[model samples]
Target chain A: MTDTTVKEPVQFFVTEDPHHHDGDHGEHHHETGTMLGFWIYLMSDCLIFGILFAVYAVLGGNYAAGPAPVDLFELDMILVSTFMLLFSSITYGFAVLRMDRNDLKGTLLWLVITGGFGVAFLYLEVLEFSHLIHLGATPQASAFLSSFFFLVGTHGMHVLGGSIWLVVLLIQLSQRGLTHENKRRVMCLSLFWHFLDLIWIGVFSLVYLTGVLL
Target chain B: MSDHAKGGHGSLKSYLIGFVLSVILTVIPFWVVMGEPLDNKGVAVAIIFILGGAQMLVHIHYFLHVTIKAEQGWQAMSMGLTILLLVIVLSGSIWVMFNLEENMMPAHEQIERVRNLP
Candidate 1:
C-alpha cells in the first residue's frame, strides 16, 4: 500500500515536470513573486505614511501658543534638501539603467552617488531639526510641533534605512558581481528609493510649502 | 510579458523628462510662494498643491515605472486603491475633525458666563 501511494505521487510529478521544466519555471516564479511581494510592501508603507499625513493635517495648526511653521521653517534650506532627494532619485535610476546593461562598475558608481545624495539629504534634515530644537520648537512644545516632527522624522528615518541598505547592497554587488539575485535586490531597492522620493514630494509640499502659507 | 519581465526600468530620455518636469513643477511652486508672483494667497496655495500633485505623477511614471500594463495590471490597480483610500482618510479626517472642533467647543459667551458665575 505504501509503495503504491509513493508511486502515485511520483507519476503525478513526472506529468507535471514536462510542463514546468524545473529550472525556468522556478526562476520565473521566484522573480515574479519577489517583485510582487516588494510592491505590496511598498503599498503598505504608503498607507502608513498616509496615516501620518492625516495626523499632521489634523494637528498641524495647534501651536499651543508656541512657535509656528513660518517661524521655524527655512524655505531656502528646505528647497536645497528637496533637490538633494530629487537628484538621488535620478541617480538611483541611472544605477538601475547601468545594472540592466550589466555594467557592474557603473552600477556601483551611480549607487554610491545616490547614497551620497541620500546622506546629504539626511544631514540637512538633521541640521533643520537641531536648529528647530535650539530655537525651542521642541516636539513637546505643541501639537503642531509633535506631528511635524513625527511625519518628517519618519521620512528621514526611511532615508537613513535606505542609505544603510545601499551600503550593504554595494558590498553584495561587488562580491556577487551582478548575479541574478543581486540584480533583483537592486530592483527592489530602486523601487524603495524612488517611493521615498515620491513621499518627499508630499512632505515638501504639504509640510514645508503649505506650512509657510499657513 | 517581455516588457514586464524587464521590470520597466525606463529609458534615459524618460528619466530626464521626469527630472526636468519635476524641476519645473517644483520651481514654479517655490517661485509662487517665495516670489509672491500672485497677489492672492489662495491662488498661490492652489498653484503649490496642483504643481505638487503633478510632480508626484511624473515621479510615479518615470522613476517608479508604474503602468497599467506592468505586472498584469496589478500595479496600477493597487495604486488606484491606495489613492482612493488616501483621499478618504485625508478628507474624512479633516472634515470630521473640523466639524467636531466647531460644534463641541464652547462659545466665548458661554465661557464668559461660566467664569462670571464662579
Candidate 2:
C-alpha cells in the first residue's frame, strides 16, 4: 500500500504504418513478380547465345584455306583481355555490395571501375579483330572466321550495352537515392553482369582454348 | 524485399573466393593449351571444359547468389526449366546442323540416295 500513488507512463514504438499495410503488401508482391519476369527474360537471352554457340560448333572447322585460330590468335593478348573482363566482374560485384550497404558514392566508384575494365576489354578485342582483318583474314574469308566474329562480336556488343546501362543506373542512383525499386534494378543488372561473365568463360574455354589446342 | 535485398547475401570473402577459383581455373586451362603439358589433346579439351563448368558454377553461386537458400520454389522451377530448354535446344541444333552438313558432302551415301530419289 506504500504504493504506488505514482503511475508509469506507457511507451509506444512506430514500426509500420497500419493504414497502408494492405496496399504495401500487394505492391511488394508485384515487385517480386517483376524480378521473376526479369529472370525469365535473361533465360531467353541465354537461348540466343546458345543458338550462336551451336552455329559456331557446326562451322568452327570451316577455315576455307584462311588463317585458322592457332595462326591468328595471340594467347597472351587474349589472356590480358580475359583478365580485364574477369576483373570487371569482380568490380561489378563490389558495386553491388556497395548498393547493399546504401553507400551511393562507393557504388558509383565501383561501377565506374567496372565500366573502365569493360572499355579496356572492348578496346583489346577491337584491336585483335582489326589486326586479323589487316592480315587478310576477315570474317568473309571463311565460315570459321564468320562464326568466330559473330559469336565474339555479339558478346562484345552485350558488354557495350551493359556499360550504357551502368551509366543510366548511375544517373538513376543519383536522382533517386536507394529506393526499393533501385535496389531491384541493381540486382537485375548484377545478374546480367555476372551472366556475361559466365558466358565469357564459355567463350574463352570452348572458343579460344579449345580452338587453339585442336 | 527479401533478406538479400537488405544486403549481406554473401560477402567480400565470398567474392574473393570466387575470383581466386576463377583465376586458377582459367590459368590451368591456358597452361594446358599454351604449355602443352598434356600430350593427349582429348584429355586437355575435357579438362578445359570441366573447369569451365566448375567456374560457371562458382560464379552462379557466389556472384549471382543462385542457390537453394535463395528465394524459393518458383525460382528453382524456372531455373530448371530454363536449363532443360537450353540443353535441348543446344544439343538438338548442333546435332541437326552437323547431320545436315554431313549429308551435303559429295561422298555421303545420304546425298547419293537423295540424288537418286529425284
Candidate 3:
C-alpha cells in the first residue's frame, strides 16, 4: 500500500502599501485594485466596441452602389492621422515615465501633449467623414456606410472621452499633486488612452488601409 | 526632460522607420489595387484581410507599448482577450450577415434597390 500526502493550495490576498513605482517590483501583498478595476472597465468597454465591430463587419461591404472605399479614403490624409495618433500614444508613455520619476509637472505636460494629438486625430477623422458625406456617401446611403460610421464613430467617441479625461487629470495634477488616487487615475487613463490608440490601428487597417486595397 | 527615454517614440530613427513603413504599406496598396478592376472578389477579400492584419500589428507594437510585461501579465492578457472578443464578434457576424444578405436580397441588384429607394 502506497501512502499519498495531500497539500493545501495557497490563497493570495491584496495589501495597501502604496508607492511601489519601480519596475523591479518585489512580491507585495497589494492586489493592484486600481489596475484591476480599470481592467474591468476596459473589458466592458471592449464589449461595447465588440458589438459595434460586429455591426461593422456585418454591413461592411454594403456600398449601396455609391462611392465605396476605392473612391473615397485618401491615403495621404489617413497617413497623417495615423502619425498623429501614434505619436500621441508614444507621448503618453513619456508621461508615465515622468510620473515614475516623480516629476509631476513633466508628467502633466506630456499628458496634455498626448491629449492634443488625440484631438488632432479626431479632427482629421471628422474632416474625412464630412468629405465623404459631401460626396454622397452618407451613413443612410447603405449598410457599408452605416457600419463605417459605427466603427469609426465608436472610436472617435473614445478619443473624445480620453481628451476629457486629460482635462480632469490636469486639474487633479494642479490641485492634488499626484496623490495616490490621482496616481491610480493617471495609470488607468494611460491604459485607456493607449488602448484607444491600439483600436485606431485596427481602425486604420480594417477601415482605411484595406478599404483602399479592396 | 524625463528619466525613461527608452520608452515610446523615444528616438528620431524609430519614429522615422515606423512612419515610413506605415506610409509605404498604406500607399502601395492604394496604388496597386485601385488601378485594376478586379474580376476575382475572393482575391480582393484575401488581400484586404492580409493588409488589415499587418497594418494593425504595426500600429499596436509601434504606437502602443502594450508589451508582454506591462503590469505583470495583466496588459497582455487583457489585450489578448480583447482581440479574441473582437475577432469572434466581427468575423462571426460578418459571415452570418453576408449569408443573409445574399439569400435575402441578392448582390448588386439589392444594392441598386437600396439606392433607388425613396
TM-score of chain A of each: 0.89, 0.86, 0.83
Across residues B47-104, which tens digit of lDDT does each residue of candidate 2 receive?
9999999998898888877766444556667778878887897789888988887666
DockQ of 1: 0.49
Task: Provide the overall lDDT of each model, using Cα atoms, as 2-decimal numbers.
Answer: 0.87, 0.81, 0.69
| Superposition error at A1 for model 2 (Å) | 47
lDDT of 3 by residue, B1-118 (tens): 1112124223444445655665565554554455555767567656655765676576556544456755566767877887788778877887887788669876787789989999
Runs off by more than 4 Å, candidate 3: A1-31, B1-81, B105-118
Question: At residue A108, what lDDT does model 1 achieve?
Answer: 97
**lDDT (Cα, 0-100) at B70 in candidate 2:** 45
Best by lDDT: 1
Q: Write the per-residue lDDT of candidate 1 for residues A136-164, one digit (tens) a residue.
A: 99999999999999999999999999999
- Per DockQ, what order, best first? 2, 1, 3
Query: Where is model 1 chain A poorest over a 10-residue stretch in terms of lDDT?
Result: A12-21
* CAPRI grade of model 1: acceptable
Best of the two (2, 3) by DockQ: 2
